[model samples]
Target: MLSGLLMIVDMQNDFVTKNGSLYFPQAEKVKPVVIDIVKDRMKREYDLIFTKDWHDPNDLEFKRFPVHCIKETYGAEIFDDLKFIIRDYSKINFVMKKRFSAFYGTNFDDILKNLSPKHVEICGVDTNICVMYTVEELKNRDYDVVIYENGVASYDEKLHEFAISQMRDVLGAKIEKWRSFNAQH
Candidate 1:
């Protein structure tokens, strides 16, 4: 069993629900897939980490969008059943990242070092920004990044497609789909 961490990024209500500050159609579509990945990934005993975009309702970050994903609100909560699905009695490092990079302002790097992960599979919402940003961070540190394309959800199909391309072309990461990864990796 190779040491690996599944980075589930910003698949919360603020980005999934229609009323979200920056909702994307594909994100909602991929919600079930993300949950399934989390469930299955946990059974493998691999490190499961989620990067939440818990923003202040009136933060300047929302100036581009609006107030959403405030703490304890529906938007802030992980997508439905995502909570019930992953049985974590042991506070499994669910960090809240204020910026696009999960590495910033959080103990993400420290946690990964503890896990000592050799490979990272990043899946979540907002493809172009957070996903791309985090992938680059991991690459800079020479981590093998496996990006689950369908496992991630994004706003704007153009951005989503281009994001994947960017990872493959620029980052030298493996690009795979959810179904492909589900086929007994």
Candidate 2:
């Protein structure tokens, strides 16, 4: 078994809250599980990170979603209920993101490289998009990866299931539940 980090995706207010333009209530629904996972990781002395969508309201992405994550905006912060204890600031780096994919134009990869965790357990919003890209990047780099199915939520169940299914069969990732951490694959 390899050491791991919980790479939480963008669970920001803009894309998740009901009042936000690109709301995904489902995203809010699975948040507790994600938080629980982080809490568990902390107990194991593993890294726990959250990716923030720190964007300009005027950016191109707003043209498509109409929601924003501008700096200092309520929409830019992590969801209120999902906040977990910070075991160590060094292990819990928050990557500010401008686009849907947290990897682009961000030192997210560098942070992960520094941590050198062999397995990355990803969870959070938009399973078919950001989550998929993150896992793909990790796979390309030959990093061990797993996705906690119960720890994430998406706008559509089909896309969510399809994305994980494809990742499992094609990307060679292991898809399991939030509590799956306690068991061996």
Candidate 3:
């Protein structure tokens, strides 16, 4: 079994694209870093797991945030920049989520039980919301987590910084520059 998991969370068009309704403004800056990490991790044979914000048009989440990433819409698709890097669609493990936390109402926990990686490395948008919530759950389950500082971004700078601090300080996650470590088996 693959010894580690690389989670690319919420890297969908609606969150990363400029034309997206709920676009993270700094998403473009983080895109290349994310892609590079993905490429590097792929070469190392880490299990690649991606999470998408798949929601119904009437999802309750739309009440708090703008309507976006509705299931089957172009906006809900993976970002074009990241799509090309996927060499085998069958090998990719996709978790479709409706809430902020990927583990919420999803088979993510079961997937984790099967993969049982030594650690989980994460990258993606909305550092304070989706990313943070997911990390919180992972930590709750006692998974060693590493958050790629350059590979994650948010629309709000303050919230982003706060989330990073909480993930590192409180949640006990390692916050590192992307690709700073060698691949582990």
Candidate 4:
């Protein structure tokens, strides 16, 4: 039985790979770490959930940021490196979000409620933005949350550190390095 869920937020090509419209170089650097976490989890019984920024071409969010992850585009797809590992398509939940917070404008909360995972391990790109919002929502909903520090990254180094500290201190999340987090599980 699955006791927990591994929530991979915004690990799409646009955020984690080179030549993407909104690429974060730091995100690319953590790909190996994220991959290791996912691979290790795949060998276990936990559920894996992947969230993608499935924005519209004319999305209002484009006003503030560059066009990215337009639905059905290469940028909207998961990074090629991790694509094949998503073998259990039926068990994997793919949440599509138009906004930064996965809970907003989506059925993420409903899905979480149904899964009823005891713990939710969150890891992905833009630690200060999308990942931060998701962590806030998860905590507000009273879910046990753990963040893989090494598996998440942000373009801004300072913001990333601040977000991690906030998630730990303010949101009551347990932050652990991927290696240590995986070893115990």
Estimate, for each residue in 1-185, the C-alpha lDDT of model 1 and write its tens digit.
Answer: 35878888987877887777667677767887787777777877778888888777677787776776787678887776787777653536788877889898889889888888889988887889989999989999999999988888677888889999999999998998777336766
lDDT against true structure, model 3: 0.90
Tell me the tens digit of each residue's lDDT in model 3 across 1-185. 64988999899999889899888679998888888888888887888899999999999988888999999999998899789888564447999999989998999999999998999999998899999999999999999999999999999899999999999999999999875434432
Model 4 residue 1 distance off true place after TM-score fit, in angstroms: 6.4
Model 4, 1-185: lDDT tens digits are 33888999899998888899989778867888888888777777678889999998999999999999999999999999888777554568899999999999899988887888999998998899999999999999888899999999999999999999999999999999878435766
RMSD of each: 2.2, 2.9, 2.5, 1.9
Candidate 2 lDDT over 20-85, as tens digits, reads 757877876687777777767777777876888787657887667765778788888787766534
TM-scores, in order shown?
Answer: 0.90, 0.88, 0.94, 0.94
TM-score winner between 1 and 3, please give it.
Answer: 3
Q: Look at candidate 2 and give me any clashing residue pairs.
A: none
Off by over 4 Å in 4: 180-185
- Model 1 ranges off by over 4 Å: 89-91, 180-185
lDDT of each: 0.81, 0.78, 0.90, 0.89
Q: Tell me the lDDT of candidate 1.
A: 0.81
Mark the regions of model 3 whose C-alpha exceeds 4 Å error after superposition. 180-185
Could you tell me which 10 consecutive residues in candidate 4 have the lowest summed lDDT?
176-185
| Arranged by TM-score, best first | 4, 3, 1, 2
